[model samples]
Target: MFLKVIKHKTAWLAVLAACLSACNTGNSNRPTDTPTSGTIHISVDETYEPLIEAELKVFHSLYPNTHIIADYKPEAECFKDLLNDSARLIIATRELNAQENAYFKQIKISPRSMLLAWDALALVTNRENPDSILTMDQVRNIMDGTDKERKWQIVFDNPNSSTVRYIRDSLNKGKPLPPNTMAAKTNPEVVDYVARNKAAIGVIGVNWISDPNDSTSIEFTNKVTVVKVRADYGSEFVKPYQAYIATGSYQLKRGCFFVLREPYRGLGTGFATFLGSYEGQLVIKRFRLFPARINAVFREANIQ
Candidate 1:
């Protein structure tokens, strides 16, 4: 009897020692997996910062555990960040060019891109100005500096921006824009410049004139008026309205892109998916930009 009791006690001690050893060694016989949580770094162009910031806030609310760090820079610099592997994702107004794609491929990083939404390039003038419309030819002449007379005062959003490129491309067709047109350092500067100068016409993104029901929009409209661009005779010169863009009436529209490194997994894939989701599309619509996917069913149902 004594021997059996002693054996039982020794067996219990051995089992407890094995369990404690496993715990102390930080090795479990069962499968052990750790949860992943980290910050996602995103670099975006200044042109799309406002919309991106708003979208990020909503994203954060849904993903409370994950953190996002956003860096806003010019489109050129944002691309540089991606090339340097400093950013996981890049949001910009334009897609990567052939040379950029080649660079990524050379570096063993094939880029994946998604078109999030379409934004229009707006031509604006002081509210006090009587002219409310402009033709593409007139705009082209001003941008190309071929007008010579400077009859139509022209201003660019920024010196190194797609806005300037658009103006140059649209006006020059294949040539280059003249050096006479004014290039502002920032979007607000362009807006202020046009607001103060009645003769000047400022070119900027349609996102600047967002918020139809807000005080900012009212104030902007009161100070400056958006110009209507006419592409043809039957097609009336229309402002950059959401409906107009959705119907393909706006001729100078550009698609916003989500550019990321290859494999398209992790943060890059997640961010792109969110941007293309219904909630993200609605956010774009709220910013007065046109979503790539048209929700015709929702539109018709919402229509009273």
Candidate 2:
């Protein structure tokens, strides 16, 4: 279960979607009871390795009999797993598009999608680089492929990753990505690359480098410093800390979604619901990402 989903775990393990009639008829492969125990595979966006891995560790600790094989990849590949039934459960940044829904409908797999967490896209640079703050305008210009005077190299976890899509579409507003953009195989690679290259800036999910209490995040902090981003509508420059992400001060924020294509209350349903439960929300909070299912408050009071 402690698989390093760093660069790549395996090639696309595609499979056929299980039909509804077969599942409804109490198929031998699917669960029959409340589904507290079983072996299943869940696909996840690679950017979420830190938080998702933590959650699964606790889940497995609680349910010693249940086994969950997690395949972490770029967002597009995760969606492919969901579509082909190689993974009945997936954690992604968005829900199924209309065409994806239509495809599932034809296959008789009604997917249950829900928001699990709120994660901000974090920009990072080497500790030696003194320029730590980036305005949303500068961010847009860098990705817009129009600025020639300011040649900043931008790196992402993967080309098809949600972080890339958010930076390219949400930030650039449909502008073509600049030729200076680069893709690392994984989030850690982005951090490592930025840490080694003073001129490069890396974009990643906040989950990777948010929590000070987390050992992995602490290592990331030691490697490179997270870049503070100025809000498009405000003057304050803020990092992707929990407070900034929750208060909307961090501009490049996105949602975490769990899309399950389970016909019955099987293992997929159980795990999906587990991710939104109270305990689950607490786990997410510890990682510094906002929990979507439950209310979490962080107050600021002067110590005097």
Q: What lDDT would each prediction earn against the true structure? A: 0.76, 0.84
Give the clashing residue pairs of candidate 1, or none: none
Task: Estimate TM-scores for all models.
Answer: 0.80, 0.88
Error of 2 at 72 (Å): 0.6
> Mind giving the per-residue lDDT tens digits that candidate 2 earns over 1-304?
4354532343222212235555656666546434578888889999998888888888888878778889999999999998888898999999999999999889877889999988888889889988788788777776776656556788988999998888777877777788888998899999999999998889988888877778888999999988888997977998888788888888788899999988788778877888999988999998888898898778788998
Per-residue CA lDDT of model 1 for 164-217, tens digit only, reads 776666556767766557878777778889999988888877876786655655
> Which candidate ranks first by lDDT, i.e. highest?
2
